[model samples]
Target: MQQPGTVDEVWPSHAPENYQCPFCDMASGEFAFPDNLCEPGDLVYSDELVLAFIASHGFDPEPGHVLVTPREHFELLYELPDDVAARLMIVTRDMAVAIKRAWHPDGVTTRQHNEPAGSQHVWHYHQHVLPRWNNDGLYFTPKRPIVDPAVRARKAAELRAVLEGGPTRH
Candidate 1:
């Protein structure tokens, strides 16, 4: 079933661009996408081989979350060549550290790989890092707030700092 509208626009259009994937195309700058999506585009960190970005269709299971992705657009973790798989950990680690320091969250949750039975939405391989709160009207699972712009800026700063080299204090 459709997980709502986020993929609606992205999915159908992806096929016509000569079999190109939107995420990969977006990361490659071969197409135009929304700007200032998360302080400065969905992409936060990108190199010749990898790219990290804040999730755009973030009607999230939890708030203050981000997604780190690879440039080549592998469909699943197992699809990645060994070298790419290793780099994914580095990106995940860096994102986790930044999320911890910036959000002052009670903890962070890391998850990857879901299935038809596991509620995985996008087919592309990516990692999710969710910032947690303490007794913040959330329980067994989590909830997303309206995500104010000011908070987004602060978060961008926090992630940027962590990327630069800040302590990942709890």
Candidate 2:
């Protein structure tokens, strides 16, 4: 399917000059950037097309928030090819299930942002899979401090184990 919009006209990139995309780095098995909060052990799932990992920043009382992103760089949702967008959505659904199985949250939510006005700091396209509970106030509360790597790793492991040998899709 054609992209819904004229990407060039509707979605301008926000990346800075000489931008080193952290998600691309993580997908390629590199996480050495000093500014990047993601770590090697934070990855929970991967395939030829996408990667899913525990986010470095999370809401209070819920630290295992997940991000599903395309292996290739796509600055905004309007830029994704149909196949990449399909795979991204599939992985997003799988990550949400994994979160439910691992964390047993009262509920779950997924969100994607496109531009600066939409609060998308990262230029790459990604979907957030967050565990939700009643009265959690996820939208109002600020993200908690950068989570410790060890905790993130553990959370990743939990979801990784749950997803291992779980599904195979192309």
Candidate 3:
């Protein structure tokens, strides 16, 4: 059931004091932290409203997972504008197609989290686009370490190449 609600009543931000937002840094082309997981090289796609990049962390046996997020920093889904939300979905779907073209997996999966209880680690709202194979165990697998920059870059390059070929055909 859908519950109509206001942002304040439904979503409370969980960011710590003086938190350095990694997604914002990536969106701004300023991935400037020594320990930040995301890097500029991980970026696969970006428009005025959204950005898609390979996730630094990935599920085992299914590396190079992608994260699609809005350009602005919205700590939780409750804060996203309707237009931003629509753009996120559009980008998410395109990333799925790109992943399919690049990896040829059996299928694709999309996931998003809200608060800590909902498994959201980063304060930014992101939708995950994961390529799925039978028995991949994605739901059961914990995230692996932050992938190496070169590897992430290679994956990003693959997706970017696919996306650059223009919109996918039906």
TM-score of each: 0.60, 0.76, 0.76
The better candidate by lDDT, 2 or 3, is: 3
Which scores better on TM-score, 1 or 2?
2
Scored by lDDT, model 2 comes in at: 0.84
Candidate whose lDDT is highest: 3
Candidate 2: stretches off by over 4 Å: 1-3, 6-11, 140-170
Worst 10 residues of 2 by lDDT: 1-10
Which sequence of candidate numbers ranks them by TM-score, best first?
Answer: 3, 2, 1
> Model 3: what TM-score?
0.76
Q: What are the lDDT scores of the predictions, listed in order?
A: 0.64, 0.84, 0.85
RMSD of each: 16.7, 15.0, 15.4
**Candidate 2, 1-170: lDDT as tens digits:** 22224433445679999888999889888676778888988999999999999998888777779999999999888777668888999999999888889899998999999888889988889999999988888866667899999999999877776556343332
Query: Can you write out model 3's per-residue Cα lDDT over 75-95, one digit (the tens) per residue?
Result: 888777778988999999999
Model 3 residue 119 distance off true place after TM-score fit, in angstroms: 0.6
Q: State the lDDT of candidate 1 residue by residue for 1-170, as single tens digits.
A: 21112211322211223443556666767565443233446667777777777776553345457787788866665456556777888888888898888767787777886544555555567788777776554335557778999999999878676555632211
